[model samples]
Structures are given as C-alpha cells and as structure tokens.
Target chain A: MKKESISRIMSGIDDEYIKEAAAPVKKSGNIRRYITVAACIAVVIIAGIILSQADIISPSHFSSEGTTANESGGGDKKFPETATEGTAEAPLDSFITPGEEIDTELAIESVTRPKWEDMIIPMRYGEITLGEITYSSQCTEISSENILSKLGEAKMQGYDIYTDTYYTVTGEAYSVKSISTECAVAVRIDNGEEYFIYVNSWYEPEDLGDFISDLDLKNTVLFRKAFIDEYKHSDTASEHSQRVYADFDDKVIWDMLEDCLSAENTEYNHPYDRIGIETDMPLLGYKNISFCITPDGYIITNILNTQKCFFVGEQKFREFDEYLKNNVPYKEYNTVYELNPDGTIPGKGEDGQSTPGFNPDAPVQISPPYDPSQEEAMSNTQQSSSPEIPQDFIIEETTRTE
Target chain B: MDDSKIITLFFERSQNAVNELSEKYGRLCLQISVNILKNISDSEECVNDAYLALWNNIPPEVPDDLKTYLIKVVRNISLKRYHANTAVKRNSFYDAALSELEEVLTADVSSENEVLFKELSEKINTFLGGLSRENRTFFVCRYYYGDSIKAIAEKTGNTPHLVSVRLMRTREKLKEYLRKEELI
Candidate 1:
C-alpha cells in the first residue's frame, strides 16, 4: 500500500496555496540566429568530400569474404552485415560452416530434498554403525547397493570405469577434500540424537590420514576416525586409492581456476591441468565436471560436481563411458578442439613449456567438453613459440571441406 | 508578461492566457509528462491537454505558484496513462524509479491499506517540504523526473555514486519521517 501510495505521490497533485501575482510569460517572438560564415564554409567542404568519396569507392571493398554475417559462418558470398535470420527449417543451402560447435539444450527439473524416513537405513563402517548412509535429494538418492548396481551397469555397457585405475598415478591436481553431493547424508541414531554424517576419506584415499581430523564432526572425531580408518584400509581403498590424491582445497579451487584463466594479472601459478567447465551450462552452481585433457591424449573422466580430478598422464583423457555413468546434465554435441600453445592442458603439462600444435587424429582433437576449453587452451597455444599442426588433421579437415 | 498580467488574462477570460501559459510552461509540462509516459507524441498531447485543463480550472482554482500547479497537473495526467499502459508494455525508466521507492515504501494493496496510499502520499509531501533545497531537488529528480542515477548525476554535476548516496539518505529520512507519521 505504501509503495502504491508513494508512487501515487510521484504522480499526485500538490494542493493549491493562496497565490502571489504570477510571473508573466517571457518571449513569444522567435529569435532567429544566423549560422557563422566560417561554420557554413566548413560544412560545405566536408559534405563535398563525403559526396565525392561515395562515387569513388568500389563495390569490391564491401566484400563479405572473411566475415561471419551469421553464426553459421556458411561462407556465403552474399552475406549481409546484419544477421541472416530465417526459419528453423531453412537448410544449409548457401554456406558450409567449419567445425561442429552446436550445444544441446535440455531442461533441468528441480525437486525438494527426499524424505528422511524413507532415506534412513542401517550401515556399518568398521565398528561405527550408521543410521543412514544415503543422501536423498530430488535429483540424487541412491543406496550403496544402488551405487554398486550403477557401476555394474556401467561396466556391462563398457564404460571403462575400472580401467581408469591404470591412469590414477598420472594425477595432476584434484580436490580430494570434498565429496559428491550424492554421498553427502545425515546419521540419525536410536539415541534420538542426530549427528553429522559426511563423506569420509572414500573419495581421496591419499587424504585418509587427516580426513577424520578435517571433519571436526560434533567432537565425535575418534568414532568417525575409527570408521574412516577402516574404510581407508578396506578393499575399496586398495582399489580406488591410486586415483584419489588428497591436495584439493574446495575453498581455494575456484581461485585456482581464475588464476589458470588470467595468470599474469596475479601472482598465482597456473595449474598446467585444465579445469574444463561448462561456461554456458552452470548446473546449480555446480561446476559440472565436463572434461579436462592434457595435450597428447584425451579422456572424458568423472562428472562429479564435488570431485575435480586431474587427467594425470594423457592429454586426451578418453573416459567418456565414466562420464556417462554419472547422471549430471551436459550436452554431448557441444565439443571444441582446444590446443594450448604451451603444449599441455592447464595443469596437465609442465609450467609454460612449448607444446605441439593440435593433432586432429589424437584424443585431444575430440575431448573439448565445453566452450571455455577453446578459449583457455587457444589463448595459451596462441602465445606459445612452438605450435605444431599435424599433417593428418589438416588433410582430413580439407577433405571434409571439399 | 509578469505573473500579475498572466493572472489578469486568466481573470479577464482572454485567449492570450492559454498562449502565455504555453510560451512559459509548455517545455516544462512536456518534460514532466515525458518523465512518466516515456512517449514523445503522448507527452506532447498530455502537455496540450494540461493547458486545456488549466484553462478550464483557472478562474476557480486560483493557483499561487503557476510552475508547481502545471507540474502537478502534468504529473497526474502522465501517471494515469502510465497505469493504463504499464501492463501492456512496461516503461523501464518509470518502473526503475518506482522500484527504487518500492524497496523502502511497501503497501500490499490490501483493502485495509488501500487508503494508506493517499495518506502516505500526503506524508511524503510534508516530508519533502522539510528537506533542504539540494536534497529535495535530488529526491524529486529521481522519484519525480524518473531520471536514471547516471542522468541525475550528469545534470547535477555530481558523481553518480554521490547522487545515489544522496538519494539513499533522503529515502532513509523519508523512511524515518513516515515511521513517525505512523504510515509505515
């Protein structure tokens, strides 16, 4: 009501007061001023020069030889400076654009967090008993058995979820400190006390030593510690330990990404390993792990918002099957060929070293998961002294173009 | 012509009274109209209509300040049009001004609070009268003229931040004044 009233005030009339004699209106006569002779002469001269140039200019100068009049960049000679907008059904009749740079759009539906009663279940880690081990959100709610089933299905589908263990030693930089939102849950016991139930050192086996200490969960560190300790030594630990190197600071990782993007502006070191983010696709502030690559080989690894892993050895980290296993939203068609001038991906290669040109045939040729990879890697490769282009990719691209 | 001459023309029922008013306040009325309406042709028509409205109301109305009366008339006319058209196509400039005030002054438009709008308007006018000349002009430029902060700064020759701060302080003062008036 106040807003409407105040707005009314902005529009309302002021009350009439007893008047003093009003001031009479001033000049009604038009006072015509002449243009200065010098100004007239200058205008005439400028107009003459403009008019003369219009006739002198050639049609060849206004060519659309190298410009993208439309986003398609179809190389149409008759391209207008303005966008060539048409119906969606309009086929590529005139121009053929270079490279596939289309991003798929999929609507994301948000749901409220799942009910605690349905989510609660008994679980044991070492001697510590858990009231519930699963975090049930509208998007993600899976029991341990469900998770195993998912991994098993992925394996049956030839997702290479297990063979990725081979490249675990080739690690770069990753945040082992954080756990996936799927693994984040609550532990409500029979004592009627609800304590914190978080991800133990399960993700980063290397950080298992201080995982319990880092949690500081309700002064029950000893109890959590015993449980974490047992998980660290279990068969899962031996199996997944090689992949999880624990130096990731969830708090400081974004700062690292900023540094990797704009390194010279600040004093922060550029991690040779790139954090390939969906510059366009921001899923609930979760930097949906697209894919990061070194220079030589490519791999589409894990897509956990919490775990940012390093593509240790190969530049083309080809673990797309692993990416498919995680039910995160991302478009498969939106790919770019990113070649860092420094020879390696942001954190994957050595510091500021000269890297080779893009190999269209190599795994790196295919692993650009998002748009920023083109921007970050292209900027890096553009400045580098040693930029190599493989003969095969050039021939292949040319053949396709023809 | 002087104020006495214009008032005399109004009293004598002369057609020159309308012409004189146009020469003196046509631009000013158009400015007030355009501030809210954001349409040139519509604003021009509104100003012309204000002159006609003035001609009809003058002998009985007997305004002390011609400038204020004209401003008030044009603002009211423009706002009527604004209310009518805002649902169809929103004027960002006028909407921005209203939203800025909306942050501090809120009435849910409930049946109980319907009259509160008019009361609040009266209180705001009283509050404006209490402010300094500079502060009053600053407040009016934003809420009345519906000018952008950058525009107010440019015209006032103050920095945009300074103009914004002054407007903020004035709104704060208005808030306190309204609270004391029990209109909040």
Candidate 2:
C-alpha cells in the first residue's frame, strides 16, 4: 500500500508484451491507410451535402403567421391594459406620473378582440385526475374494516376506483393533501389560482381493501385546502404548484423518497390508521412511518407488518395480508422493531439534538455549562502564556527533518 | 536526438533507431502496455510494432511527445489484443476502467489525456491509501494484477458492479480532488 511499492510494481511490468502487441501497427501498409483516409473524406463530403440539403428544406415547415401575430400583438398592447389584465388594478409605476394621459383608445382598437359569438362557450380549467397508483416496497396495504366498508359504500355510490402509490413525507416542505386507506393525495398550488393535486396509492392487484383503509380522506382535504390558502397570497403559487406536480411526474418525489428510505433504514409501512395520520401535524405524522434499505443500499422496502399494529383492525389487516400474498412480492422477516437495534435513528444526532437513548454506540452527551466571561479570561491567559516560535526556526527544523 | 534522424536511420535499414527508441522509452511503453494487457508477450509486441511504425511513418509524421505517442500506440494494440482474446465476456473491471477514462474525457475535452494521466496516477495512489487493508489488497490484486471481475468479486466478497461502481466513484472522487487542487 506504500507509494514507493506501487510505483515499483507499476514500473516493473515486463516490456516484451508491449513490443509483441504493437507488431500489427507496423504490418498495415501505406496503401490500406490511404484507402481508409480517402473513404473517411468521401463519407465526410457526402454527410455535408446531405446536411446542407436537409437544412434548406427545414425552414418551409415553420409558418410565420403565429410568430408575426405574437410579436405584433405584444408590441401594440398598452402597458396599462396588460397590467390590468394580469391583476384587476394597475401596478404602481415608480417612473411614471399618475395624471399622465395615456392613449388607450388607439391601443384598444389595434388589439384584436374576440367576436361576441366566439365568446358564447364558457372556458373551463382542465382538471388533473388521479389515475392508478403504484407502491414501492416501503408502503404496505392498510386494512381497517370501517374504511373498507366505507369504500364499499362509496363504490356502490358509483365513485370510480383507481390505483395509488404511497410515499412518506420526509420533510415538512412537502405533505399529502388527502389520504384514504387506499391512497394519499398531495396538492400544490400555483399563482394562488391554479391547483395541482397528486394522489398516491399502493398498487398490488389484490390488496385493494387494505389500501383503502390506510388513508384518512378528511385530513387530506384539509391539508390540500391549507396548502392552497398558504400560496394564495404569493405571486409564485401558480408556478410553484405546476413545479410540484412536475416534480412528482418527473419522479423527483419518488427519488427523494428512495433517498429518505435508504438513509433512515426503516421499512416503509403502509399509511397509518386514519386516526393516526389525521392529526393537525400531518408533517409529524409522516415521520412516524419507517423505511429500510438492503444491506448493500440498493433496494428499499417496508418492514412493518400486521403484528406491529396495535389497533382494532386485525380482521381487515388479515385481508391485507391475504391480498399482499396474492398480488405483491412480499417477504416476511421475524419481527420489525420500531427503533434500530443499535438504538440510534440512522440519520439524526450529529448536532446533538437527538432524543435520550437514541444511539447506544456514541450517545449524545449534554454540553458542559458555559460562562462567557470566564472563557474569555481563560483564552486571554492561554494566549499570554504561549510563546511564539519563529517561522524561520520552524522551517529550518522541517527542512532538516526532510 | 531528433525523431526524424531516428526515422531516417530506420528507413535506411539501420536497426539503431529501434535501439535509440528502446533506450529512450522502452520502460515507459512497457509499463503502459502491461498495465492494460497484463501480458509480457503482448507488451513486447506492442513496443516492437511501435518502433516499426515509427520507422515507416516518420518521414511525414513527427511526434512532439515520443514517449506518449509510443505509449498510445502500444496501449491501442494491447487493448485490441485483449478484446480479441477475451471476446464479449468482458465485465465490470474493463468497463470500469474505460468508463473512468471516458468520464475524464467528457468532463474536460481540452487537455484531457494529459490531465487524465496525471490525475489517474495521483488518484490510484490516494485510493490505495484510503482503503482498509483488506480492500487495498483486493484492489491492487484486481487492478494492478489485471485479475478478472470474478476473481475480484470472490476475493473481496462483493458483487462485480459494487466493485466497479466503487472504482468508478473513486475515479470521480480523484477527478474532483484534482479539480480542487487545480491540477485538472
């Protein structure tokens, strides 16, 4: 492992192999080389000719109508009108005087207006619907008889059923807007006016009942409303809302979930009972879920099972167990522990804010009491007592040693 | 001595050009070829081919860095032989090595080869130092010895990709370290 040893070994490799392997490079004569070079040049010329022809043809496909209209229309529109269109009131202009007469009539006339007949049909905002949900290994199917019966009633009432995927809310910055035993919904608001909602559910073929029981639908709706209200006053709400949805679609949320699961080393269990996740602190409710990663840190999955649940949903939990067996690739371990056997949460305690008995190996210790004045006096004493060494002396000693 | 003079000597059917080239860069070419091919015969053939090619091409082509040019020729020849001998059964070890070089090339195309060679030399040393004793031994035996992926996997008790990924990550880390040092 020493530097010298490695260099020696690297240098000591035999020379005969290099000479023998390089023999073929000398055998290929000038005729073959010339032909290869000529072929390459011909290919380049042909490619250039084809590319130039393609470039000439490409411009015909794009129409100037849309571009010209957008540009001219944008230029002719008065600033005041556009400002009013964005919001009901005109934004205050620091540079312009309020009493200045603006030529609104000519500007209004130049801008094209929709015909009265064309305005008859009401415009509707597109609604993003929750589709089938899929679950990774971390999430489990929830089983609550009450939720199952409610789902059955809802289905009978003609509510369309869909699939869902579950992800733990690792950070408070992102939380689910709604939950059912079957799914959890997260909403993001854009520009205070638009809303993007993501509904996640466990998607094994057989465990529909358990999935339904896991979500607390009422809390989800509340969370969605709260999120919308928080963003309504901000200018970025609309953009942020779209970004949130895009984040989910782009698998950013899933990727973050995977990171959290691996880092936490806790099994991603199914959504907690409606009673558990429906609290005022939905963010905290997310932290209660567990995730575990494989030893080599590749695959992550949920480790908790039915026996771990202390509530009165045993029969419904059994249905979930059966469903998982029939639909999902489920593996059972001996027992799931709430805390790691090492007694420390995987990622906490670096800054010493961790709970007591958190880590057995390196328990976080309480800092000794501080007296600022005393510490300042001690620092002064130490500085005064210490002798400064000459830089030249230090250099001389180092050079001599080297 | 000038490369043209050596080439002129070779073209004049004098074996002195080969002798001069061997005297100048015999050890360096051997090191590079053996590093890749890990065979004595292959390395020797590559060096000889480099000399013969130098003799034939030197009238028109003049190399600025004779050592690098010769090493490159030897490396290419050795790799060709390695590929032909091993066929498509190549695994993570070769892939990792190529990927490391590719990553270096892609990240900085200007002065890539020089920067890569320097960084690689430094990084391999750093990586060896950073590893646990067992891992260090395993790494040397695999990379330095040109041991196959299966051999490395069995010895280190790790999956081949794990080893490959680790090596790839180490190379990236080295590049990063070199960047921090302003070496690349």
Candidate 3:
C-alpha cells in the first residue's frame, strides 16, 4: 500500500457512521443519581468542615457529652459518630493486593481451541466395497432433494452451505455412523472396502462454512472428499454448481481465494492460475477479474487478485479463520472530517480555506503568524522567559514560506 | 490556548468546539486507537467515533482536561471494537488488559468498572501531582501518551532500561494504591 493510502485509511473516518453506531447517550438516571449523591456527600463534608473549623463540633465535644447525648439522642446521632470513624482511615489493605503487579513487558498469549474437540476431520480418497458398508437400519437413501432439504434445515438452524462442484458415481454404500441430528453413511462398491460420507442435518451452514473454509483441503482430503461424494448424488450437479458459484459472490470468494493463494498478484506473471482459474482463460485480461455465479446458480464466491498481498501461510489461514469464527458482523458507521496537521478539526479562515494551525474554539490564541521583527522579538522574549529552551528554537527561518 | 476559553467554547457547544477538539486532540486520539486496534482503518474509525463522542459529551460534561477526556473516549471505543471483533474465538489484548484490571477491582457488576475507573482517575491525579517535574513528564510520556520507554528515556536523559524499570515500578505502586483503597 502507498504511504498516502495507509495514512488516509488511518485518518479517513466518516462522522455520520460513528454517530449512527454510537449509542445515544440517554440522560442516564444513574448518573444523575450519582451526581445527586455526590452533591449530598459534598454538602455533608463541607458542613462538617465548617462546623469543625467553627469549633461548633469536635471529637472532644463528642467525647465530653457522649454518654448523656448518646442515650437521649436518636439512633441517627450514634450512627454518624460511628460511621465517621469508620469512614476515616478506611483500611486500604482490603482493596489492594500487594501481589497485583502490572508487568510492563507482559505479552498476552493467543487463545487456542482444544485439539481433539475442535479438530476438523481429515478427508481421504480410497476405494471401498458394498458388503463392508454398515447400513444403519434407519439410514435413508441419498438424493438431491434429501441433501437440499437437509441443507435448508441446517440454514434455518444457522448453517451456510457452499458447494464447489458435483460429479456423480454409483457405488456400494455403507452406513458408518448415526447421531441424533444426522447419520454418517459410507459408500463402497468393491469387496472389503468403505468410503466415508458425512450426513449431518444439525450442522448449521454458517458454522459449517466457517469449519469447511478453515480446513486445509490437502491435509483434510478425506473430509473434503466425503462432502464431494455426497454432493455428486444430485442429478442437477451443473445447476447446483452454478448456484454455489453464484452464492460465493465476487467479494467472499476473492477473500477466500486470497487466503488460499497467499502469493501476491504482483509477484507472479499470472496470479489467476494460482487461484484455480485457467491461465489461458479469456477473463484474465481484465484489471479486476471477480467470480460470481458458478456454472449453476446455487451460490456465489468472490475472486480478487490484488497487487498488494500478504503471504498468509497455513498457520495464518487458521488464525484468520479463528478470527472470523470469533467475530460477528458489527454495525459500522463512518463520517469524514477534515483535520489540521496537529490533529484538530479544520475551520475556515477569512480566505475560506482553513487557517493553518488555528483553532476557532481555542481560548488562547496559539503562536500567531509572525512578522520578521515580531518573530525576532518573541524569540528574545522566549529566551528570557525560559533558559531551558532547546537549541532548535534558535534555527534560522529559511524554510518559512510566510 | 487559554484553558478557560477552550472550556467555555466547549460548554457553548459551538462547531468550533468540534474543530478545536479535532485540531488539538485528533492525533492523540488516533495514536491511542492505533495502539489498541493495530489496524489502520479500524483505528481511524475509532478516532472519528471518539471525536463525535466528545462533541456529544462536552456540553453536558465539562472536562477538566480535554486531552485526557479525548484519549479516554478513544481508548474505550477502540477497546469495545476490539472486543466485539475478537471475543469469541480468540482472546484479545483488550481482554487480557481488562482481566488484569478485574484482578485489581473485583469483577462484580455493581462495583467493577465505574468504581474502578473513578478511583483510578483519582489515584492517577494524585500520583501525577506528587511526581517531580521530570518524573511526571516521564510517566506521562510512557503511560498517558503511550510513548516507548527508550524514547522517553532519550528525551529525558535517562537510560532506556531505567525508563522501563521506573514505569514498571510506578505501575506496581499505582496498583498497590488502588488495592489499599479497596477500590480494586
């Protein structure tokens, strides 16, 4: 990124967005109550101070009249005296633990998920047989409608489904496992073999997307193949592919592709090839080649090949996925305000442009634009006012444009 | 600028108040946000949000120190954003810092944040007042201004590591004071 672009990103903010995101500071009743309570305390403290100074009330007076006044006076009088001592010299030991130290060098460790519990199942491509398929008596036949219905159910339960491609094949099928929400069915055609198939209706698509997206396909080939195998069962494979392609959209798929291909576009002669696009593909000539609508119209994915890219390794991809998993979409509002170099809002001068380094709201005028003689005089005065003035102040004004 | 005049303008709720605040404290707020958020876009957003928050707040709440007020606003907003973005999957620096604070002030809903913040402000004020001119500047540079220890030491003619040690000790003292007050 250009330095100016980075600076702009750093400084460019939208005011309107902030205004919208900000919770309107309602006149907090609690704050008002606090102020009232503080006022009351202040009044009490001031009164006590005044009375003490006037010698109208003193500790000695309380000691002298104690027993007689204490007995005759109501419980309130006795309470205040006791509370006064209690309030005075309140023990600090209770609040401060000596062991509590702020380590200036303290670096917080990154959070991690439990290995076994959070691990994504690996995908494997291997041959399997029909007789080896353990059919759950309850295991239902696989079909496009069945898969779509299951996916729809998962979506209702907050899952997101993104199908990459679908190819069909007939084989002996096996029922591997069954859970409450869905069952895992393994398909095998030849003898003494098994092919894994994941069937889970309870898998929320949004969560599944996160889970699947995070998976390193090379390492989790078995798991990936399982999904691919099930997807192939549908007759409308082309239609489904189109839908998946459309669903991924340009932005989302590009972001995913960016994660997948850490190589910067600038680094390669053809970065599109790394992102699974055909190198000879006619679409490569565009300044920005974005992906949407697959061959079928089921889903969309974005594809972005940026000039500036950070090479995200496997670990980084995992970290990024973890970040996405934890973070939810938050409302963002932004508004732009012009700023002076010193970082204050800019206001128009007599000339209509903002007066450089001037703040209209400033109570005291800062260093005014200098006439040469006045500048010399101010410097002499500054020297007299503070002998600790730095040497930089004495430099000649060669750079001064005014 | 005259502090009183600035305070007066802020009370008046003039557009100039926003202008002056952004001019005087915009970089400071940006620096605070950047330090916390680490992402330029996010930090920039936080700074803008802080300015708006100050604009809304100053009329009703006349701050004694405008710089501190702006910094606090930026810090709070950036930290909130940080939490929202990273709370579920990954533990964030904000969470760690807050958890550390929770140790000082028990994390009871009633007595935690508001009471601790008020107490912290008081303690910081008292601490700043008690420091020698040089030490006060050093403390401000390291903590309030978030300058590095080496930079602070070089600016003040102290050793780099000495600056670090002094900051560490000061933080411990402040923590102790908070604990002693039973406000932690």
Candidate 4:
C-alpha cells in the first residue's frame, strides 16, 4: 500500500480510542472547583488588563504588523499585539489614555470588597486561612437570557456539571488543542436565575503573570495552602487521609501564579469546556482559591466558582509541583495514621469510633507535630460561598476596539 | 449547541445545523485545513467545502461524534488539496507525518494490492489495541491527526524530545508488527 493510504487506514481505528485521545483526563474535585472559581477572577483581571494595557499597542506595531479583518480574509485578530514588548517594570496601566484610564479603574474598583451586597467571592482557596474572600458582584446580570446574548454569537452551548450551569460558548472550542493558533472562547453561564460571562482566551497566554503583576494585588491578596495525603494503615491496610494546612507568603503565591500564568499554551486541551464535576481529590493545595497545578500541566482555579481551567504547560506544572514539595512548610494535623502499626493507636472509622487497626509494636511512622495554630485558624475562618458575577467586566465592543 | 441538537436539526432539514456545526467546529476545521494547505485563503475554502459536505452527509449518515467526523472530512479535503498543490507548494508538517509513514511502508503496490488494504488496517488496529493508553494516544495524535511532535508534547505534558522518541519507537513497533503479519 502507498504511504499516503496509511493516513486513511489509520482513520478506521476504534472510535473509543479516538474519543479517549480527544478528551482530557478528568481532574479532581478540589482542582476542578479551583478552575471554576479562579476562571472568573482570571476573566475579570484579563479583561481589565486588556483594557488598561490597551496602550501596549504602540503606533509602530499598527504601522508594521497590523492587518485588518478585510485584509486577513476575516480571520481572528489577536489582542494586545504589543504586550510582549512591555517590560515587567512598566505597570500595565501606563499604556492607558487618561480618559480611558479613569474609566477602567472605576470599572475594576467597582468589583472590589464590600461594595456590592451579593458579593461574589471570586476565590476562596484553602480551609486553612480562608484566603481573603476578595468580593465582587460587579459582573452579575439578572436575566438569564441576557447572559447568553452577551457572548456575542455563541457557536455552541455546553453544560458545566460542577456549577450546575449551562453556557453559550463563542469562538473555536477546538483551538484549545492547537499550539500555533491563538485560542479565544467566550463562555457565558446562566444558572437558570443569575448569569455571568467570562472570556477564556490564550492570546500570548504566557503574559498572564505580567497582567497579574501589573495589578499588584499580591500585597493585598491572602493565599493559603493545604497539603493532603493518603496513608495506608500498617496493620489493616485501610487508607485514611491527612491534611496539612499552611499559608503561602503573598510574594511566593504571586510569583507562582505569575509563573503559571506566564506559561505558554502547550497545545494541551484540558477541556475548559463547561466545567464538569471532578471526583478524584488530591491532597495538595496552593491557595484557598482552590488552585491546583494538575499533574497534566494545567492550572485550575475555582476563584469565581466558574470551574475554568487553562493549560500552563508541563514545565510550569513541574516547577509548581516541585515548589510545593520542597519549599512549602506544612504542619500535619490528624496524625493518628502516622503512629504504630500494631493496633496500639486505634484507627478512626467512618462513624468516628476507633477501629482496631493500629499496631504499637510495629515500625512507627513519624510526622511533624500538629500545630494548634492551624486548627485555630480553620475554626476561626468562616468559609465564603460562591459569588455573583462582577458587574462591569463585560467588555463593550467599543472597549475592545479602543 | 450540542452535537445531538445539531444532528436533530440536520435530520429535520434545518439549514441552522450547518450554521451551528460551523460555529462550533469551524475554527478547528479551519486549523486542520491550514495545517495541510499552508494558505489561509485555501484553508478557508477547504473548510467551507467540508462544511457543505457535512451538511449533505449528516441526514443520510448520523455521526457518533460530529467533531471527529468533521475533522476527518476536513483533513481528507485538505490532504487532497495538498496533493494537488505538491507540484508547487510544500507543507512541512503534513509532509513530515506522511514521510514517516512512507519510510515504514516504502514498498509500492498497484491495483492488485487493494484487497489487502482492509486486512492491513485491521492488523494496525490490533497492534494499536496491544499498546498502552499513552502510547496509543501518542500514535493516533501523531500519525492519524498529523499533529507535530511539539503539539503532541504540549498536549500530553511531555517534552518534545520524549514525544519524538516515543513516536519513533511506536513507528518501529508498527513496522515490526506489520512485517510479522506479512502485510507490508
């Protein structure tokens, strides 16, 4: 057979294999929540950054590389064409026009803490610190119908299982799989009563850190980390869970977030399609934002409870994983599993009654002493619920043009 | 819109099915075309043609996965265009994938060998079935989808070098398997 026929022959492979190849691996519940919530924050910040950094488009870029829709046969136009040229030192707002600058700030500030009553906690990451429940209800819309309309022309509609929400998806859903093509998907969710829209795009996705850095929310933002591990009972072989909670230094969190956001799109398609319920629970956590650098090299955040996910490439995933493994300090709580395997220290059962699984005579596993402070913080913190959408984040057509 | 809804529209003879299908999968279809044709105008035209083909075919034939079906059609159309343009134009990405297969199945065959094509396809499927999930995904993504090594690496969360090495090994295995089956 001719070599060219091989392509055709390969197409007849089992449909199951094809489907398996196309679908991304399912993520765990906590990470899924992080992606959903954090996606909303990413949407607001990205849209705001796009507006503030609009001036990153130096006139020189327009003169040299700019092509109009008509010129490019109506192909997609990439935004912030000149953002790469901006140095880390230059704040993103520096690019804005004075009139537009004030307007953009007003839009952003409207979403900050305590202003709107239906305050949406865009991200509450960990159980340890309950990281600052940064509040915003600026993007919420009353009519479910209006939410779908805001997405421009939705080419497709999908359901997000985690939020129990339906979405109108605009843009190329498949481009998330391609590395060369710039991907942009505007996902609008209507939870039957209230709705919010977020645009998830990878236009120089690597610049997310720069955008976050520009906002300089690091100092004000609180981050919490949770390390969860599963241990096997030495005597009974029954598995139990252990959690270690710690706070991330704001700078470290910010730096890690930047590194993750700055990661180039690695042509991975982890299906930020409508968020789905993730069941496998991993033990590690980055911030109360429920941020997880998934093993498959994607960063997920449930900050806005949107369950939005994006690819951060493998290198970034490894770096984040390594940082969590080596640098972060954890005070383990619920250390009964670490004691003797000879049934001396009784294992806790589902009913909270001690099961006979511990062995005092067997080799003992040691863990760091439990810190009362971690438990105290967990008790003192009141977990925030999912927030309503921010109000002004919906970009006007003119805003994008400007 | 979901594939089932789109298919229902197609079954009902609604023109909106084409719009919904194009809206949802058009960008990806266009990307597939662009990868092979290497011309935006040509790619656009090829994708439009594929859409028309999809519209015509869906009523008579229901697809289990519209996205995959549409992609196969798009790739076929683009490959046809690529072959037609081979005299003057070259697409390194598409050619590289084709060349790898060419190296493995270098023996030329005529019309008489057409009967063996089905058996060869089945043998290949059996070979793929024996592979681990990761290796199977890597093979399909590379040879079947015509994805570049870098693209596969990014998608699979592996370095390009690792993807390339794995694909080479897989291809070697395929050659050996085919030889054992006496199909090549």
Q: Which candidate's lDDT is highest?
A: 4
In order of appearance, the predictions have TM-scores of 0.33, 0.22, 0.26, 0.37
Query: What are the Cα lDDT values of the candidates?
Result: 0.41, 0.35, 0.37, 0.50
Residue A222 error, candidate 1, Å: 47
CAPRI classification of candidate 3: incorrect
Regions more than 4 Å wrong, model 2: A1-136, A140-402, B1-35, B38-99, B105-120, B132-143
In the range A64-151, model 4's lDDT, one tens digit per residue, is 2323222113323333232222111122233433222233234344333221113332111011110111112223223333222221
lDDT (10s digit) by residue, model 3, range B1-184: 5555766777887678777777776776776566555567888898888878877777788776566556667866876676566533133322333333333334233322454444445565665454334444655554333345565666566556545544554555556765776655
Candidate 2 CAPRI grade? incorrect
- Report the lDDT of model 2 for residue A99: 44
Candidate 3 is scored at a TM of 0.26
Lowest lDDT 10-mer window, candidate 4 chain A? A393-402
Candidate rank order under TM-score = 4, 1, 3, 2
Model 4 misplaced stretches (Cα beyond 4 Å)? A24-402
Candidate ordering by DockQ (highest first)? 4, 1, 2, 3
lDDT of 2: 0.35
Model 1, span B6-54: residue lDDT tens = 8779888999998998898788677667767778888898888888888
Comparing 1 with 2 on TM-score, the higher-scoring candidate is 1
Candidates 1 and 3, the one with greater lDDT? 1
Question: Residues A117-195, candidate 3, lDDT per residue (tens digit)?
Answer: 1322111112222221222211222332222212111000100001111112233443322221222333332222333
Ten contiguous residues minimizing lDDT sum, candidate 3 chain A: A153-162
Q: Evaluated with DockQ, which candidate comes out highest?
A: 4
